[model samples]
Target chain A: MNVVDLIKSYGSKTVVKEVSFTVPKGKVLSLIGPNGAGKSTVMGMISRLIARDAGVIDFEGQDLTKWKSKELAKHLAILTQHNNVQMKLTVRELVAFGRFPYSGSRLTPEDNEMVDKAIAYMELQEYQDQYIDELSGGQRQRAYIAMVIAQDTEYVLLDEPTNNLDIYHATNLMRIARRLCDELGKTVILVLHEINYAAFYSDYICAFKNGRIAKFGPVEEVITKETLSEIYKVDFEIMNIGGKPLTIYY
Target chain B: MNRAKMHRRNVTRLALLAVMVLVAVVFYLLVNSHPEKPKLFQYILSLRLPTLLCMIIACISIGAATLIFQSIVNNRIVTPALLGMNSIYSFLHTAAVFVLGTGSTLFLNANLAFAVDLLTMGVVGTLIYWYLFKKTGHNVLYIMLIGTVLSSLFGSVQSAMIRVMDPNEYDALLGSLVADFNNINGEIILFATIMLLVLAFVLRRELGLLDVITMGRNQAINLGVDYDNVIRKLLFGVVLCMAVATATIGPVSFLGLIVANMSRQIFKTYKHSHLMVGASLMGMLALIGGQMISQHLFHFTVPVSTFVTIAGGIYFLYLLLFKKGAY
Candidate 1:
């Protein structure tokens, strides 16, 4: 997927301006930036969750806007932050909703098989019957991810998937994102606040600063202290951990 | 719980509610018929049947409307009554009597009045929802707030009109203001039933997406449900149902709130197909039981809405205080 010259403005304030990037297939790309840097806005625009004022997004050599929403949903799935499900839904019921794009409320045998696989993938088998509201934060996040997985889309977009999760669960989620690309050959995009997780788990990192791309390259090229300090407006020291660059900012 | 077990449980609960409705219907139909006076028994049955049909239609419409409205707004505490549809109904009747002197064709002709009321309410309600949603970018809270404000605005205007009007005109207007099961016209009931059937036919396809809508706007859109279009269609259906039921049998404010919540609590499921059915059954049971009690126990001294309002008010309080997070 390639996005060229994207622009979005809320009233008088332009949140995203002249942003451009290309996503490699079957690889993980993380959008990392400080608050108000337009990473999420870019993500939202890319997934068509938020309308763009001006842009051209080429998905498989076709304009993204030309793709029908239902047909596009078959190839791409997105999980936004703050998924507060108000209804009383079981884990199984929630995951089954992932098959809605295919079966639409009536889960065929194949849809059920995909739901089962997603449930097992998320390791939520024991809690499949448990109500979502009764689960812990991390478990509920996993259930949502499982739903996205069950969508069986080749391109997955996760906006701040690690929000409100503990470090252990956050790391676990990162590993799952890695496996989603490495094992399943799905292209994944993420909006992340933790730069280290982006460096360690993602193959490419796009850093946003003030609604424009500060740097976009491989992890090794973009995870340097100079680029981190320049983008975040803070001093940064870098250390190698597990053969990946980790940032220590002050 | 396993899926099969949950399915069985929901079915059993629905069956139990159905049986309760049946018992209420039978008791309502046969309890006071005098066997000694056969002619009187037949006359009473004839009188009672239309009222039964009106109550059934009103309850089903209110129940289904409330459930669907709640799902679209993604809120369990609200009902279509909050949209000021009932207030509009009362306001229209009061205005008609006040301006037209209670002798106009719109005031005296039940069928014509029913058509006018339904049309006015449906159009006005749809306009309010459509305009506000467009202006506010589909914010449910803004629509609800505007609805509450409009309700009070109409209520103030109606009461002001009622106070200065002739006592005879006020008396004529009183029947349409409060819900009265005994005085509904047979023709109006038939009209409402036909309108309801049309609405049911139009909304059958959209009703299938109610479960997806319960997941909220973003998820529904992500699942390719065409959130805005579906909401528009469903909200229009809600307006029609509310208008038809209110115009046919007057406005029963709290019945929808009571029945919809009770169904959700009992079924404990997100699928609106089950929720709508459960709510309709519970609504039928409530209306039938309330009418029976008003006839037999209270000897027609108390109106059925009195029972529903008081019970529903107390239940609303219980839901607010005790069942805060359960919904």
Candidate 2:
């Protein structure tokens, strides 16, 4: 996916301005930045959850805007943070909704197989019959990720999938993102707050600052102390951990 | 709940509602029949059949419309009546009587007035929904608020017109305003049935999207549902159904609320197909049962809406107090 000069503004205050980057296929890419730095906005634009004011997004050699919504959903799936489904849905039922784009409320055997596989992937088989409202925060988040996995898209965009999760579940979620890229051969884009998790899990890092791409490169290149300090406006010290650059900011 | 358990429960609930509707229909038709006088009984059956048909059509229209409306708005408490259809209905009737006078053809001809009411309410409701949704960027709260405001505006205008109107004309207007199954015209019932069936055929595809819509807009869009297009079409369908029901039997505000909420409570599922069927069945039972009481018990002295309002008002209060988060 190639994003060229994407711009978005909310009532004259531009949130994403002239941002340009290309995502590598079959790899995990993380967008990490300070609050209000337009990381989520860029992700939202790529997922078509929010409209772009001025830009060209070339996805698989076609303009993103020209792609029909239903058609695009086959190739891309997105999971935002606040999924407040007010209905009384079981975890299986919620996951089954992922096949709606394909079968539209009528699930074939193959669709049910996919749903079962997604639930198994997320280790949510025990809770498949439980109501979503009755689950814990971490369990519910896993249920949502299971739903997205059932979608079986080539590109998956997660906007802060770890929000409100504890350290154990957060780490688990990051590992799942890695497996999504490595095992499933899917391209993953994430908007993350914890720079450490991004540096650890993602193959590529695109740092944002004040609505612009501050740096876009491999994790080793973008996680350097100088780049980290410059993008986040803080002092940073980098340490090599298992050949990966980790940041310590003060 | 497990899938099998929930499915079984839904089936049981639906069967119960079906039986209730059947019992209501039987009592409505043959409760006080004079079997000894075969000719009189036949004559009474003829009178009751049209009224029963009218009630059934109105129930289906209101039930399905309310379920769809709640799904679109993603709220269980609010009904399609909040869209100001009822107010528009009352306003049109009062304006017709006040401006055209009771002696006018619009008032004298029941079919003509019914046609006018259905057309005006459908068009105006669609326009209001379209304009408000576009202007507010699909903010449902704003649309509902404006609907409430418009309802009060029309209500005040209607009352003002009523205050200065002649007593005889007011009497004429009163019969049309409150729900009355006693004086239903067979032709209007036939027209409403045809219109509803046509609407059902036209909106079948969109209706399938209602399950995803209950998850809200962003999720619906993410699931590859054409959010805006589907919503616009479904809301239009809702307006048409509301218009037909109100024009056919006048406004039975509480019937939709009662049946829809009861269906949701009983079924406890997110699928609109199940909910719609359950709601329509419950609506049939409520209206038929209420009509039976109004006819035999009250001797047609009380309108059916009175019983429905009292029952529905109590249920609404119960929902508000105890079942706040259940929906």
Candidate 3:
């Protein structure tokens, strides 16, 4: 995926401006920034959820806008931060919605296999028959991710996938995200508020400050004290946790 | 969908359909049972046919329209009546009576006035919603907000006109405003049936999309449904159905909400096909059953609207209080 000079504005306020980045195949790219830093906006633009004012997004050697939405769903999928649905759906039913673009909500054997595999991957097999609203915050988040996994696209973009998750589930989500890239060979992009999770799990970290990329590089390069303090405007201390650089901003 | 679960839901729906048909039969015979006139069969056909037809059309249109509207808006509590069709109808009726003194030919000729109501409200009401949907960028909340304001505006204007109007005219206006099964126009029923048929045909394939839509806008888009186009079309369909029912039957605002909620509660699935049929049957039952009660027990002294309003209002409160799940 390649994006150049991507721009989005609401009325007069430009939320995302001239953002540029590229993600290679089979890599995890983490977009990390504070609130109102435009990370989610950039993620939304790439997924085609939010329209862009001016930009060129190239996916798999074709312009993103040139692809039909249904055709695009075969190559890309997204899970927004808020996954609240008013319908009473089981986890299985919710996962089946992921196959809508392919089979139009009809479950062939292949679609059924994919749904089951996704549920297992997310460790949600025990809760497959449970209602989504009845699940805990972490479980619901996992179910949503499982749905995205069931979409089985080459490119998966998630905005704040770990928003309401506790620490253990949040870490598990990061591990699953990594496995999706390393094991399945899919390109993944995520907007994460937890800097440590991004620093630990992502191959590339694109930190944002004020609607623009402050730093974009390999994890080792972007997690430095200088960059972290500059991007977040906070006093930062770096510590090696499990031989990986983790930042502390308290 | 598990096999056993699907079978159970189907059986429940079938039972609902059976009840609707039975009630319809009773309603037909009940209305014509006591006629003491020559050419009794003709009296039954001519007199009761239009009322039955009107009830059926109102049931289908209002039931399906409300469910679809709730799906698109993602709110079970709000109905198409929130779009102010009733208020618009009231305002138009009051304005007519206020200006023409209720003795004009427009008031005397029921068919002409009914046509005028259907045409003006159909065209103008749909236009109002269409324009608002475009302006709000298909935001249901904003459309609903502006709709409430417009309804309030229409209500005030109607009340202001009613205040100065002659008492006799006010009495006539009140009768026209409340939904009455006996006051339907045959021509309007014919028009509504044709529209309903066309709508059903057009929506055959798209009805499946409602399950995805119930997931919410982003998921629908992710599922490759054209979120904007499909929603716009659905909104247009809802507006058309609502315009016909409100213009013809004078607006039973709560019938849709009542039946739709019941359908959702009973079906417990997201598929629109089942919900549409289930809600339609439930709506027919409500109208026919309520008509039976009002006509027989109350001797037609109580309006059908009174029964529906009280029952629907009570159910609405129940949903609000106990059913805290999503729409």
Each model's DockQ score? 0.68, 0.69, 0.56
Interface RMSD of each: 1.2, 1.4, 2.1
- Misplaced by over 4 Å in model 3 are B1-3, B30-38, B89-127, B130-143, B157-179, B325-327
Q: Which candidate, 1 or 3, has the higher TM-score?
A: 1
Per-residue lDDT of candidate 2, residues A86-116 (tens digit): 6889999999999988899999999999999
Report the candidate with higher lDDT, 1 versus 3: 1
**For each candidate, what is chain B's TM-score?**
0.92, 0.89, 0.82
Cα TM-score per model? 0.94, 0.92, 0.90
Model 3, residue B100: displacement in angstroms? 13
A210 in model 3: Cα distance from truth in Å? Answer: 0.8
In angstroms, the error of model 3 at A78 is 0.6
Stretches off by above 4 angstroms in model 2 are B92-109, B134-141, B160-177, B183-186
Evaluated on CA atoms against the true complex, candidate 3 attains a DockQ of 0.56
lDDT of 1 by residue, B50-149 (tens): 8888888888899899999888777788787967878877887677667777788886787787787777767777777777777777567887888899
Taken over the whole model, the C-alpha lDDT of each candidate is 0.87, 0.87, 0.82
